[model samples]
Target: MAVLVVLLGGASVAARLDDSSSDSAFPGRPDDAASAPLGAPAAGGTASDAYAFIATQKGGSDPVTYDPCAPIHLVVDARTIVDGGMKLLEQALDEVSEASGLQLVVDGLTDDEAPEGDAVTGPDRTWLPVTVTWSDPKASPKLKGDVAGYAGSSSIERDGHRWFVTGTVVLDGPQLKRILDQRGGRAGVRSVMMHELAHLVGLDHVDAAGQLMRPSGDESITTWGAGDRTGLAAVGSGRCIPY
Candidate 1:
């Protein structure tokens, strides 16, 4: 997740009205990339969506906002990695749930088998798919690309009750393999898993250097932030729609 992994207060009355007129672009990368969305918001649009999460804020109970029982499925194959990585992911998920007041139910951990994408047309849709890539630890490169890791989709909007987030978290390559099998490997594993899970729950990088949302250069935020909580509340409340 970016840090403030943002959401789309999707299909508000105004957006639906302008869907035809707006230059629709998909916000995040899609698992079903064959079809470009008609009115999808992109990573750049995340800032705008973050703002929307705020504008649509409706209050909720102190100890309860987003449905605690809502199942947030993890669509990854954790079986391929060391046990430490899997345990770290579980703990990180627990942290996200504790922070957001929402239950992130990881459904079955299936193999990284995504059906061929349909004609990908970016509608306001998110899909969760998982993949695992393997490489030699000794031959693994030292540097990383812009995307330090990979994941499927997490935290999407659809029929009211169905909230799915299935994605990948790199686990098998050389450097990663060594790190996972190393002494006190939990640090690396936890950070990586926690970061990805953050995305699963809807967080985007923040300018605050130390926040989990901020990418590269530095690290901070062992827990969620105000924006994180607000986003969670917005999604959990199902308040994306105008009442």
Candidate 2:
């Protein structure tokens, strides 16, 4: 298994962004066919636009992705959500879901805090629901500087195929507050959420200036760009895993 972390920095702030991946040993498991895909990708973008995947299957071009047949269960930490934040979060997720054709169900709010590191499994070794939470530098060292958010998923390789099981998205509480206070700040906040959620589903930062998946955030670009849509469609249309 391997865990991939994608970092997103504040749009106005100059910050370095990078992707990191770490390997873990897990017993191999069998694979089986799954039911039909829950939905199909929404039409968007030409193939020439810029887009990238965070990770790809070894020796293959297919991006590691979540199962299309299963709903991606999500839980939010209510303690960190700002005023009106929950509505914005829901809206952002809806956009991602529509673009990717993946069903994302918000299980509900949780008392649990964000994990300090990338371990998708709990102490009992079961996969955790995709977690959305807010944290500060004191709590998460990774959000220390201009970093606005972080998102990633852990995947297990089974019979030469890889599928994302679970992931996390952590936003900077204080920085988000500042963003919310700015003109058109609500849109800005939603853009950040959408960007991080995009990362959660396997989209990577592109060098294109206008795209939401660009390395740095931009309050003005509230919606997905052409390449962003294309990538979302690719990831959301992945093979269904019945494991």
Candidate 3:
């Protein structure tokens, strides 16, 4: 309802780090201009009294640096019998991963066939991909059952990476399609997943209308600009503490 893919972008965690110098910031979300304040500081210094994770506003001026968790895998427990917009969301996520510099590996594990033991990663130097358990509107009314997704459990200690995102993101294909339709196709879809995945990596909303972290939706500026790249790089690999 209220959104923007959050903000920023970065390098391929899979890339040869030896070649790159540093990534960048401030891609700006589309919706920031029409609503909320920008670059406001947190109330006092207490973390508990801090602002909402995803907010109607943003304050801090200094950009979040890029340091993402590597090998971000995904698990898609989509319906064996796919439905409308389902395939679209999946394809988009993969494309976004490539564009955003995150390694999103999806697994096709059903709720029943879900691993008996290792939920995140197993001892075989492998982990439960992205743990995607699908559901529709009949199951989740808010999403009209059209929503199907999952959250990475907190402290999923598998491999060198930890579970950065600990919540479910119901990226409705209809809402996504409608909002993105204005901007064309691939570009719109990329924006949606890119924003959500950034949240997965621990990015907060930004106030800069020109920054990718903005909350309000904007279609005119479709691609993740330099600022968006900066924000995304910051979220991907870092000292993550998922609450």
TM-score, one value per model: 0.50, 0.83, 0.48
lDDT of 1 by residue, 79-173 (tens): 44565555666787776665555455555566544433321222364333333333232322322433334333323233222233333344334
Whole-model lDDT per candidate: 0.39, 0.75, 0.39
Of models 1 and 3, which has the larger TM-score?
1
TM-score of 3: 0.48
Worst 10 residues of 3 by lDDT: 10-19
**Index of the highest-lDDT prediction:** 2
Candidate 1 has an lDDT of 0.39
Clashing pairs in 2: none
Instruction: Compute the lDDT of residue 189 as modeled in candidate 1.
Output: 52
The alpha-carbon deviation from the true structure for residue 175 of candidate 1, after best TM-score superposition, in angstroms, is 4.0
- lDDT string for model 2 (114-216, tens) is 5545465666544568889887767778887778888887775556677787888888888788788787888888888999998888988898967889887
| Consecutive 10-residue window with the lowest summed lDDT within model 2 | 11-20
> Residue 200's C-alpha lDDT in candidate 2?
89
